[model samples]
Target: MKWKKGLTGMLLAAFLCGAPGVGIATPAHASAGEYKFDFGGGTVETGYTGVSASLSYDSARGYGFRTPENMRNVSASVRFLATGTKSENTFDVDLPPGLYEVSVTLGDTSRSSIAAEGVYQVINMTGNGAKDRFQIPVTDGQLNLLVTEGKEGAVFTLSALEIRQLSSNPVTNRTIYIGGDSTVCNYYPLDSSVQAGWGQLLPEFVNTNTFQIRNMASGGQIARGFHQDGQLEAIVQYIKPGDYFILQLGINDTNPKHNESEAEFKDWMRDMIRQVKAKGATVILSTPQGRATDFNANNVHNAENRWYRSAILALAQEEQTPLVDLNVLSSAYFTSIGKNATLALYMNGDTLHPNYGGARELARLVAQDLKRQGLSGF
Candidate 1:
């Protein structure tokens, strides 16, 4: 079989910890400004393979994964002995700032093939002060290696593979502001359990070195109320050129307390778009997530729910703003998983507020949408 080299600068160490009979030394350390973390050493039984490894930073907020900027540098190396059979393997790394390189050598005259190796550079050009963000994307910088058996009983081994970080200046930085209901607000100790919002998970997907996410969503506030109460104005004032605004509403909007009509709702959405665009910032309209109730085939509740959603869609198209169809996507996902399976994500049986898991799922979907639209980079 053919043996090739594959490596990434952002390789994770978490999975490597559990690789079969693998031993890892305390990660080698670099000076404070430039940190180095490493993972290596394991045995593979013939056809049996080793686990993929990675290293991540603890954001101290319960989010275990590290953002690109938070990741100073990463490297992965492994040595495995094959007993009888051959295996194909791939390694993954989380992308971070700096220049990266990889080298692979075959064991026992096996003549391993070097499938791939390279360097990736992430530069932040925005003037935002957040350094824990990375502008370089890791998606394109992946190395694939192929290993094959020289002879029927040939044992293939891999030696120390390394990655390094290069120094560069902090470039550009942008900000993302979130506005919505309590479901998207940050919670302190006072209202902990009841207030988990998807906005909290938004940071994970964001490359903090290039962009910062500021959540301004509050509880029990509708679209109209948010503007009337000056929350909208506050958000607008903080928005700088090249910033982005994510607006998610409709939960509290439908509440009798807000009592806004279809026309009023459309107008409000249009005005919000205009104001955001006026600031030279981009606006992304998110449809509210679906409620837990599963209307029957003939139920008209689904049709009634469409009113607000339709208005949002209409306004988005009219204003030429980007749209994230959270309503449709979440509903389809929940339906496919069934109520019982999906309930675990909701907060305290409340269809309105999402639990941490739900919030994370929502954030992932939103990020996916952003990437698809090429808006996440903003």
Candidate 2:
């Protein structure tokens, strides 16, 4: 919640629209260059500019719906900005180039996927009083937000919005790019999703003041496939010096359908490491965590993808890169907890993926390893 240097503290108010004595008329351009907007055609809250769904983007106004197709006010009393369009919609706000922390207050019954500057700030989040706050490096002098539906039949709604200028120079903030598989990717309808990746939950443990996470992991992605498909290049384009990249893959590679060899996995990972390191950024190699059922008959934890883990460990040693032995750490922990407790961590009875609780625990292990290694952004 901390901003750049020489900035005073500003306590953001929760969205309490239509509440008596809460709405105060304030000038459209507030002091300190901070902007607050109240959506949903409801009574404008104190110190916020009201924005209706119909308010199309105007250059003179500097903020409004740019692609507000079928977007309209659903409720006035509760303050809801609902969009009927099942497809993706956009909203724009003009601002000077810099790093900004956008805080959005979602409606009580809202489910949404919001991406600022193509970096997902909220993915499939839904529930009562859901709030999304994230920092984005804006180089285009404006913030283009993409909003889409989360769960089926659920609409996207925004109750309030607040933009705080974090730094005039976006480079002051470093990013931690994650390259992995579904076990480390983000999920939607996060409030109710039975499955979640460790990368999706890593932000909860990192120091946001120093680093932002961009999890580029996807389902069924192998080391070679991720690089050959140009996903690694996409991340390399944005990665800058002082940034960090974590590569955690291998589970999908073990599938016979992929037909990837252990040596090839190591080679592809090395190539990725070299490309990322060429940008003057640090590369940290992480072995995938163990599955819920990766245990021996003697109750000793064993990793199903131990071959990939061995390859990664060898590469880490050869490249002299920082390593997070998640397989070992997770396996040891699971063994200590016993079979039944470990099974409860996985989604349903599935052994491959971890549920939300499992994801959180995995992220904690990653963070702890980062700190143990004395890496930056712990």
Point to the candidate with the largest lDDT: 2
lDDT of each: 0.52, 0.72
Candidate 1 global TM-score: 0.52
Q: Cα deviation of 188 in candidate 2 (Å)?
A: 7.9
Model 1: per-residue lDDT, tens digit, 60-177? 3111112222221112233233221112233333334433333333333322222222211111111111111122212343322323332344333333333334333222237787
lDDT at 335, model 2? 94
- Of candidate 2, the 10-residue stretch with the lowest lDDT total is 1-10
Compute the lDDT for candidate 1.
0.52
Best model per TM-score: 2
